[model samples]
Target: MDLFSLKGKRALVTGGTHGLGMAMAEGLAVAGAELIITGTTPTKMDDALSYYKRKGFKAYGYLFDVTNEKVAKENISKITKEIGEIHILVNNAGIIKRELAITMPVEDFRRVIEVDLVGPFIMSQLVAKQMIDRKEGKIINICSMMSELGRNSVSAYAAAKGGLKMLTQNLATEWAKYNIQVNGIGPGYFATSQTEPIRVDGHPFNEFIINRTPAARWGNPEDLAGAAVFLASKASDFVNGQVIYVDGGILATIGKPSNED
Candidate 1:
């Protein structure tokens, strides 16, 4: 009877093969939602599907590149045909490429935008239409620290994430009348496949991160899952167009690092 429980709901997560995507899917599955995950790699998809299957969770995988509108529409249609209406959508699929803006190729920037920004827009539009017919839905966009603050290099990623923030609000403002709650979760530095290089390098970046973050550590994937579930459940029915920061207080601090007194 908990408001946060996802029992009897169906969720479709884009980019659910690995990293944060898989973590979110698993979180929803554990919350008792039937999960459908999409990704580009069949091998990874099969792996995730089998892993969840072994866990006795109802999970399925669809192969499609979300950046491609045609492919996205096609896969969505196919999924709708196979499964009934998807009540929850977790737009967790994204890509990050670090490069200096001046030196970065425009093609790389466009590609990142295609996947991180436009892809989410397409999926949200497609799914929101279906939710409109049902008069209810939940949309959780996976944003980033870069959505509000920027760092050295990675201009395209910053732009894409920032745009995603606004897109989330736009969707919520327009869709709230239909009983849909659209919101976002902006994660700070998290240890995942995306950050393995930084972790493996044992660079000062990690130290800087710990010192900068009030929590003094990077977040794990599970940290964001609870927020996703909350946003997707009845607990957050009134929450709309808001971006929750699960950054361990990274966004709260400014100035140089300080050691304990």
Candidate 2:
């Protein structure tokens, strides 16, 4: 049997217009899943759709904010009606606010939580309802290194992701009876367009990441494809409530001394 095949599966990936989300969505598509990507703007959605079409892959794009519960529900319902039941759901929509806790405004913290934590909850609940009825589904939450570790100036992001880790477990426990699997992917620093400036040679942050990570390099967006495909496919039928850290073993070891051999 082709355990990793996603043929006939329909996957809904939120915030899939670009970056890591797009990479994971492409992985599923290559594995034979029908792709439905979501963005918050029509132009972004159209552009993503066009890109996929140009690649000879048929994809659907929707403009919906996952944090808006009403809009999420409405759009999800519309998607189901227009396309079909979503067999896989990737909660990839999130935001980060890089402000120290000491001076960070209360509103910024709330906004980060709303987008990173609350948004996935809303999306999961709505999609899980359909999957529950069908007796099977897969939900992949886009968690982060912050989900387990803390860094400076990202208090809000860390808190939200930490919460999301537990949420993933809780959903898995509650939905396991219905044959649904809920998991998370904690990605490390990747060499993406968004991090282009910081990834240049001699950049402090870039040097720090290289030294801190056991792999001594930044991750590529495509590096996450295998994990995404495994968690989204039947190969993970028994794996639930797990957070796969695709962080180049950063979470596995402490760190080498700067002067160590």
Q: What TM-score, over all chains together, does every model reach?
A: 0.96, 0.98
Error of 2 at 144 (Å): 0.7
Q: RMSD of each candidate?
A: 1.4, 0.9
**lDDT tens digits, residues 149-237, model 2?**
99999999999999999999999999999999999999999999889999999999998899999999999999999999999999999
Highest TM-score: give the candidate number. Answer: 2
Q: Runs in model 2 with CA error above 4 Å?
A: none
Task: Report the error of model 1 at residue 165, Å.
Answer: 0.3
Where does candidate 2 have its weakest 10-residue lDDT segment? 49-58
C-alpha lDDT of candidate 1 relative to the true structure: 0.90
In model 1, the Cα lDDT at residue 152 comes to 90
At residue 114, give the lDDT of candidate 1.
Answer: 92
Q: What is candidate 1's lDDT per residue for 35-119, written digit by digit as tens? A: 9999898999999999989989999889988888888998889999998788999998898888999899999999999999999
Clashing pairs in 2: none
Question: After aligning candidate 2 to the native by TM-score, how far in Å is the CA of 5 from where it should be?
Answer: 0.4
> Ten consecutive residues with minimal summed lDDT in candidate 1?
252-261
